[model samples]
Target: MADPKGFMTTPREEWPRRPVEERVRDWDEVYVPGALLPIISKQADRCMDCGVPFCHDACPLGNLIPEWNDLVSREDWRAASDRLHATNNFPEFTGRLCPAPCEAGCVLAINQPAVTIKNVECAIADRAWAEGFASPRPPERLSGRTVAVIGSGPTGLAAAQQLTRAGHTVAVYERDDRLGGLMRYGIPEFKMEKRHLERRLGQMRAEGTKFRTSVAVGRDLRAAELRARYDAVVIATGATAWRELSVPGRELDGIHQAMEYLPLSNRVCEGDLAESPMSAAGKHVVIVGGGDTGADCLGTALRERAASVTQLDIYAQPGAERDEDIEPWPTYPKIYRLSAAHEEARDLETAPSADADARLFAASTLRFTGDGSGHVRSLHLVEVDQARLPVPGTGRTLPADLVLLALGFSGPDREDGLIDQLGVATEPRGTISRDAGFATNVPGVFAAGDAARGQSLIVWAIAEGRAVAAAVDHYLTGSSRLPCPISPHDRPMTV
Candidate 1:
């Protein structure tokens, strides 16, 4: 256990971020350099070492949270890292990206701020890389079986790493020029730099994980051909079918999906262009969503020096803190937690009185108005009640040169013909259907991650990937030792 009275003595402290004004000028991450190391031990020591750690139940990975906290408190960086990597295949990704459901379930959160589980997890993994403890672990002997993993996202990469270490020859195929599906293009560099991804890819290659880029499985090579060449196949194509707004003016030339606009900025960071073709520069941008993607667009638009940026949300703003009456203990609460992007945006907003936040809330977009030439010029919206009915005399208009829809994804893009070729069934909710063993109806074929479970957090994707690999190993060998922690349909107890 960590320090006995650590929770009482030490307060919850997060790693400080770079000043918003300074960070906006560059595409680098928002955190201050070397900020967490000095205080990490004290933060880790805040773990209560509860008799019943609900954090394990909260995390799909079943991460050894308290064990690692103790290890970190003791300054055993290598041991802490080993404990962290035992379940999660990609702590670095989750650390930087995940909402940290484990912290939400922390025993400390019942009465106090939760322990810094995500920060400690990230620190352990980063330390491992710095100390050369994260060297490649190639298999001793080949199992002679081969596996083809479609999609180079977290799930596919995790499964490939596990299967390769378990002695199977593994090959990952990506449709884009580079590996990392959403992580590569969808995520901005200000959140997680590509160097973190590049180093991990280098390690995977050294461990004998063959990568084939710019190859679309169903389009270029037939599904039958992929299955024929491999002993098994794992599909992690991910749900990228972006949801659309069917309101009037949907076809405005300046309006685009979040995926379309987000990736263009990512390409600019890759030196593809000095300026993104879809840039919000000199424009009045209006984002019509309230999720992480919307926040990302807000930050990016501000960096591009948009004349003004406004975000629209249909729901009213949440409370400053969780209300037990609505969302009880151990549950993920709906609270107003300011994200790094939101923090930066609040500093620049120049509104006086805000009925529903100076930006927007409880507002429904009526339609967009474009110029005669077809470029968007303005947006129309109305105030909405609790039931989303438009209120009277609440209509307003805002200038909009470029608009983005971050309304979230619907399902996997099946237009490429991969699902039809494999003959796998899809659920009514639009995700791929899989058995308890993570296998589809077709033998030797399996699915995991967002493709199977719908769009979710990075930790869940890695856990799904690890669990699916175990199932594949068992299917091939009849008996296997790989750990299968959760099945496809297991939803978290907490919201």
Candidate 2:
């Protein structure tokens, strides 16, 4: 509403990324700082403030997108931050990491480029921090109820913050030495700096949310014992078990899982190590799998100055444009995307002989070949059909010194004694089984996030946390006032 003809007058312009050559040399964020501020307000003004905002429905958090967009456009950053924080607990995290399905569902996106909702949201949150508008709000009265929240990921952190503000004594337990779960370790620092997480943790601490790191539940104490110690227990331990490749030569010395390689790089950034144990320097690197994780590996390997880099995907390359019938507007599209990492890879592929990258679509890995030193030397590959099945006549070999398996995660770590002690039912797919209310078969216990829902986005994790907190509060007090953002059975608009 800031400008009635804003959508017509201005076209969408995205935030600028740092130049490929300059950014890949270090672990800095890909986006150029201060580059989006000039155009962000204008881009935000594109929101029509429609009568029925489908973008709300598209978001798992049900973020007040239009309201905040208008507020940002008008330069009312305080009000915009309030509106953005009303639903989402971590705008900075989602702004940096989320794929922004809300933009896909923008009404204008049916024809024109969608409003810059994500950029506006990040700007509002950042301005709030700078202006001191964001502060902890502790409850005036204590309810004297104590709760134990297992996990320190987005879901557990959101639930812990909400419950603590609701006058409950909440403690968040993390198995890792530091808080932020995968956000702290699994995610590369180039995608999002760890200081953002530290600042939020500071605010949560000020709000009276207690944190217990390096003390895993069901190991330090039994699940039943934990329930006895607290009035209620909320499980948000995320899926940690990586989906593995069972092809031949899986035990080669230079072969590693994406999780193994990613965490080591993150540790190096943390100054915990001088270098990554799985460094790709001077090695011919081949990454299998073409998901976001694979792209992440590609970027990291290129930064390490690999001799050469090649990425293989079993599926055919996705179309550049969205498929209208199968994926309509107001829902996340199935179009191909060029992530920052992919952009760098493409640049490298077209660069001079000194800087060359390679990508192979519809390629399947058959096995690995190792040298006498027990280190990976090459990969056995085959050209895959449209169905992703290997074709016998199209086999070939590619020289490789380091092979990274970038397949996604499977489920929560069952080895963590928690699952064994609780005896919670699990789906055939390995995810924890929960009812519509996010309640497990056991009474007075509830589950949320990747632990229950499988691998998903931070936005979905926060939504599940909000929903699970409401159900737990209702069970505890016979009524609840917390907003249940999403149901356990509700899949994302993208799904």
Candidate 3:
């Protein structure tokens, strides 16, 4: 146990963020650098280390939350990092990007605020890198087997690293010019800096994981050719076929998908462009979805000096407290929580609309009216009930020079012909079909992450990656030593 009465003695204190005025002008992460190190130990102490920690069940990666929490509270960072890495392949990525469902299932969260698990995890990962506790662990002997992993996102990276460390010659192929996939382009620097990604990639390279960027597998090399070359192929290409909002005037200029807009901003941060061609500067932006992606668009638009921003959610606003009848404890409930982007929107008054948080809940887009030049001028919408049925006489229009659809993704993109050429079966939901062992219909071919599981949290992606690696290793050899943290049927704790 971290402390017998630590939960009673300490209240949850999160890592502080930089002032809005300062962080908005720059692309650096929102949190104050080096801030968590001082307070993280105390925060970790708040963990009860319960006899039956539900946090383990909530996390897709099955992270050893209690062990790491205890290690962090004792200031045993190396041990903490080891325990964290025992289950998770990339705590840094999940520590920053994951929504921390584990905290929602924390036993303490039944009444008190959950122990700062995410912050403690992030602190441990950052400190591990700083103290040289993280290093390459190359295989002692080559297995003489080769594996080709498609996609360079979190899933592919995790799978490749595990396979490489298991003595297989692993190669990861990415369609983008650079590695990290969405982490390189989709995610803004304000959320997580790329330096952390680069550091991990460096470690993977030293561990004998090969990377092939700017190579679309199905196009550059046929699936058959790849199958013949490598002993096994793991498809970790994430769900990228973004969902569309089909309505009147859908083709108007200045209306784009959130993925389309977010990546350009990331390119600007990467020095690939002086400015984003789809910059939201001086425009009234209307985001059509009120999820993390919408918030991401909101933050990027604000940094670009958008005249105003408003995010619309189809679902009604949730209450501040959990509705136990609807979503029970130990399950991830849909509650009203303020994200950094929403906080910025609220503080800056950038989004002037029905909701104070720069969000219009129960709102649905009707159509976009275009200016004479074919550019979007305004957006029409209607407030609705929980069933998404429009409320009568609730129609309204808002100035919308730019419209972004953050409605989420449907499935993996088929543009590269990976699925078509590979003869892999797909589910009705557009996700790749995988067996209990993460194997696709085709032999020697496996699938994982968003490609198989559909769009999900980064934690799930890494977990699927690790599990698929073990399956592939078992198929190649009669037995395997790799840890399979999760099964293909496992899902996050959600209502």
Candidate 4:
């Protein structure tokens, strides 16, 4: 550590964000650029570098948190980046997108605030890129074996990069027109700029990973044909089937799913579309769901200049502090959080303007009331009990020109044709079923990430990718050397 008593001397300081009024008008990232460089080192010093490092146990990727924290505190950014990337294929992505369970598991967090592991991590990665420490790592020798990875999300990309560096020919397939799967389209630019993704894709290309976009495996080519062409196959196709609200007026014109609304806004930001078909401009928007996706919709709708916004959740409002009985030390807690969007909403509510954002908890949607033209006019809701069952005599109607269903996903889209043709077994949850090695019932084929594990964090997806690559490598060759972070039988302690 840089200072033995640093924790006592300095309190935790996070990166500063742009003022709410200023950031709400554009799609740029909310955090102020270069704001963390000054404070992150001091924050890194707060790490105790515990004897057992429970932070590692908290992370599904098993990131070397303490080592990098020490390295950052010492101002050895180059070394810190190396340590950070040793296990993770894309620290930049995880650094921005991950919820940072490692911080929750920090030994210091048992008493005081957790060490700023996530901030230090993002700082180290940004410094590495600025100093040119991050570059392609090509293999020394070529192996005769070849592998096909389906999907361009974090899992597929990580698997392809690892296999390429292992001297095996690797080709990644994506159904979308571009690589980066959800990273490229589902995520908005305000959360993470696209430049970070582009630079990583460049490095992967330099490292001998081939990408094939817009060529779906089970649709354009038969699964049998793909199996015959490649020595082994790894499927990292993420879960894309959005869960629907089966209430009355589900087919109303202004009612749409979160996936449908989010991607359109993202594409508009990328200049691919002149305008989003589901634009929330000059409308009263109500988003149903209390998850990150709902928050994303809240932000995007605000940016689109919605007249008013309201978010509803079936669950009761979480406590401000962690509940000791439900979530113990070194485990992720269930507590109320104020995301950037929510912060903006609070600021707007206190403004002089008449329009303000609203949020309702323990609420359930009864149905939609539409005008004669089939356009949504209002939403019918009722107060819900602890189990989200509707309570009597609490029914109300609120005007709503647009309604976004952010209820999250069910599983992978079976319409992909690959699931049907391959005849792979699926669990009751609708995700592909795999054995301990991540291999499906069909031989020489493997599945990973959301496609196999259901919807989850990017870190878990990457871990699944690396682990599945090892299993596939072992299947193709008698022995393997790829690092397997987690097996199919292993579930995250925090989960």
lDDT (tens digit, per residue) of candidate 4 on 66-133: 89988999999999999999889888888888888888888888878888888888898889899999
How do all models score by TM-score?
0.98, 0.96, 0.99, 0.97
True lDDT of residue 307, candidate 4: 80
The best candidate in terms of lDDT? 3
In model 3, how large is the Cα lDDT of residue 276?
A: 93
Tens digits of per-residue lDDT for model 1 on 1-495?
768999999999998999989999999999997998898999999999999999999899999999999999999999998888888878889889889988989999999999999999889988999999888989999999999999999999999999999999999999999999999999999999998899899999999999999999999989999999999999999989999899999898999999999998999999988899989988888889988888888888888888778888888888878899878778788787788777777786722223333358888999999999998999899999999999999999988899999998877899888999989999998889998899999999999999989988788888888999999988878877877778898877654
lDDT (Cα, tens digit) per residue for candidate 3, span 34-138: 899999988898999899999999998889999999998899999998999999889999999999999999999998898889999999999999999998999
Q: What is the C-alpha RMSD of each candidate to the true structure, in Å?
A: 1.4, 2.1, 0.8, 2.0
> Number of the top candidate by TM-score?
3
Candidate models: Cα lDDT each: 0.89, 0.87, 0.92, 0.87
The candidates, ranked best first by TM-score, are 3, 1, 4, 2
Candidate number that wins on lDDT, 1 or 2:
1
lDDT of 3: 0.92
| Off by more than 4 A, model 3 | none
What overall lDDT, based on C-alpha atoms, would model 4 receive against the true structure?
0.87
- The TM-score, computed over Cα atoms with residue i paired to residue i, of candidate 4 is 0.97
Query: Residue 28 in model 4: shift from native, Å?
Result: 1.0
Minimum summed lDDT over a 10-residue window in model 3 is located at 349-358
